[model samples]
Target: MGISDTSTGILKGLVVIAAVFIVLAGLKTATNILVPFLLSVFIAVICNPLIAKASEYKIPKALSVTLVIVLFLAIALSIAGLVGNSLNELSQQLPQYRTQLNEEFAWVTNKLAEYNIAISSAVLIEYFDPAAAMGLAADMLSGLGGVMANLFLIIITVVFMLFEASSLPKKLHYALDDPEMRLSQIDRFLQSVNHYLAIKTVVSIGTGVAVSLMLWVIGLDFFLLWGVLAFLLNYIPNIGSIIAAVPAMSLAILQLGPAAAGGIGLGYMVINTVMGNMIEPRFMGRGLGLSTLVVFLSLIFWGWLFGTVGMLLSVPLTMIIKIGLESSEEGRWFAIMLSSDDDVEKYHTAK
Candidate 1:
């Protein structure tokens, strides 16, 4: 290629990068509006299966949607009330939890000193703060709780989206110049996203329930809160379960001693293993198209940009983009870049 061609290419790349930055900046600025809408979309997508099943049974779309939404609201409200109460109780009891942490740290420091380790209890307490772990969980969930104040707006949005979903294909057919290919791609994207979110959310619920039950059986404080934390964080790939376990395990150490903490850790391991490694894939049928590295990076990037909700929606958001890219010949390379090796191999094989 000519030097002028190279120069033009460089200019185009620069322009594209600048455009991306501009869009990201706009999104970040609009986060307050964006997060609720995205949350509503998430809810709407998951509820689609119920709507479809209802339709299959010859149930009217309006009645089915109303029923599904009512069910959703009931569950959401119950979780919010319970978690809110748990957080309040936790805040009230934090002083005692902190005192227990100090005693636990002192005992550890004393034991270490017996072996000539000479670590200060203050140093130990500072680094291994159970309250910090709980605070992290609290901060993450509190972000969700804050969004719940706009629950009415979200419900309306979800209702509209659900109603529109049935007509979107027909709309696209009339709207697009070449509808067939576009419709096929849109259908693929919707089916993949819906199946993924549904299965993953169910697995997450299982993970949370299992964790809460184990914690309760072990007599850990704030078991319900930790369970909810597990459910929310499970949306994040790879490291989410670890993050969820930290606070609960820390509390277990402070309240129930190291043995109970060990048991709690073991329970988390088994629950995550069975759910993530075994059950999730069995239901999901294949890997998420994005690479493991991409998943982790998106979690950090989205979390940084949008906080906890961003982290929670990171994989879903990235998967949506990857699928969108794959819909066009020109964009498939970019999609492949976002994909796992297995996905890349399949893409090539299919091509």
Candidate 2:
């Protein structure tokens, strides 16, 4: 390229990068307030299915909302209870685990002795130090505190959002003074969101159950944890399964020793490969279309902007953005670029 063109390209790239950073900083700031509300809205959408089913049984709308809310809260409390019990049990076993770890370290040192690695137990202990491990535990607890706080805020937001959900469209319509058109747009937006959620929920649950069963049969330390990871990560397209597998494999190695760990890791790899590469593609089809590049870039963008939770929500959030863009004439090209080529062709042919 010519110098002038190269210089222009460099300048444009810098400007774009600066703009992206500014937007990311704004998003990070907004997330403190927006995350809880967005989470609540998503929860309300999931519960809408149950609410509709209840309406089919001739239940009043208000009563159906109330019923779903109660059921949701009950499930939340039960999960909290289970997590609490698990935490307590883990705390009690901590010392025993530490001892086991020390023994394992010594065993490793002994085995290495045959290789002429004359490492003393004390030296090995120093190298394999538990102090850093303790520090990690502390950090984890601090993170857990933040997560729990976020969880409580999310629940509060969800309750209020659920209470006001049915009236929201009407309120917006009245305020806009174009009730029918506004309501129609709102309805379409909601339908798109609901469709995305339904597909995501089914896919995530299926992946989680499959992973959990595999882990359980293989005698992994925490099948449930891996299952939960699978479910949460399934929302992230392309790389989520890989990210989820790392912790599962690492923890397996720590708990089950290398041979068993290898087996567990292989199981995870196989399951994820089949689900992520093959089955998911077949099932997702073209309706909630997203491009491979869009999916990968969304992972990096959202993950950088909002941490682990953002990574988990990346694809859905991107899909939602794509849907919004698709709904507008001027932005249709952007939406098309975000979709699979196959889907774009289908859309064009249908048009």
Compared with the true structure, all predictions reach lDDT values of: 0.87, 0.70
| TM-score winner | 1
lDDT (0-100) at residue 81 of candidate 1? 88
In model 1, the Cα lDDT at residue 227 comes to 93
Summing lDDT over every window of 10 consecutive residues in candidate 1, give the lowest-scoring window. Answer: 281-290
Off by over 4 Å in 2: 1-23, 119-153, 167-189
Model 1 vs. true fold: TM: 0.91
What is the Cα-based lDDT of residue 211 in candidate 2? 89
Candidate 2 lDDT, 68-135, residue by residue in tens: 87788796666455545545655565566567767887898889998998877777556544334334
